[model samples]
Target: MTDRSAAGTTFDDFVAARSTALWRSAFLLTGDRHKAEDLLQVALVKTWRRWDRLTGGVEPAEAYVRRALVTTYTDWWRRRWRGEVPTGELPERPTTGRDGPGAVDVRRDVLTALAGLSRGQRAVLVLRYFDDLTEQQTADVLGVSRGTVKSQASRALAALRSSPALTDHDHPATEEEPS
Candidate 1:
């Protein structure tokens, strides 16, 4: 699909182009595929309702949708059911040999570490680190001050560092923050 300027972009085109990336962010936020689909759909519906306004405004459609995603996630977190449902058996899939052993374990540990964080901290980390949004952008998406973003990211990283699930793994060098 051709990339169009915001003024020329249709809601359908924007969804076709950005839905995958947006779904990835949603997955990171919700940490479950089904929940991510729900979150993404809700955010997209909100965006569609405001398509003209969002496309006409200074911000891009993506920014509006991301903000919607985050706000909706926070809202859901407040009303979420805390009880767990038991499953009779685990779903099995054939593993690829490419990632080597313990990759699944590492992923599980990372998710566990992320699950330990508060919703705000997890949102900050996902938007800032995984989504590669600037601190200001993350602040805008989360509707918080830049200082709040910085502090939350700091606390989140510290918590991850101290998480028993992650301690055994060697961390790579940190990337320099953008100015």
Candidate 2:
């Protein structure tokens, strides 16, 4: 195997590969576009510092970066920082640009439901459902256990099920059927 230190030049390739995915994850978590950009920027910086260890690419290069974004988003390092939410529902797409309208409102409603969760509950839900990881994998990312992931996901979804904004909308994407 090549020296782990010998991963190729870290500038353009890394940015090209992972930026959009990271931003989407951030936007989903924060429920705002500008904050998503800032979140991805900060996560990239942390990833760059650890690139040599991460660029091995044995698994998705994105996994490490995504974990960084989630962790940084919750850290107490920014105690003074505050995030903004539109008094109304978030725009289906960034007003700075545009996207298709179909099903966009559905997605926005789900995100609004997620925003009502506590930080850890939201992280567990995003890591499990959106990222399509197993309970074990999601637990690893959140530094918890499989049981914790299940428990937290259940709590998050129960809260979501009760959200007024989620009325009459099915979130099969984020929940499981009971046996």
Best by lDDT: 1
Q: Model 1, range 1-179, lDDT digits (tens) per residue?
A: 23334577877778888898999899878767789999999998888877766656434788999999999998888878344222222233345698567765665667677777889999999999988999999998888999999999998997887777676677432455466
Give each model's clash number. Answer: 0, 0
Local accuracy by lDDT, each model: 0.79, 0.71
User: Which candidate tops TM-score?
Assistant: 1
Tens digit of per-residue lDDT, candidate 2, span 99-144: 5444566667777777678888988877877778899888877788
The residue pairs found clashing in candidate 1 are none
Q: All candidates' TM-scores?
A: 0.80, 0.77
Q: What TM-score does candidate 1 reach?
A: 0.80
Which segments of candidate 2 are over 4 A away from where they belong?
A: 1-11, 58-60, 76-98, 102-104, 172-179
Give the lDDT of residue 100 in candidate 2: 48
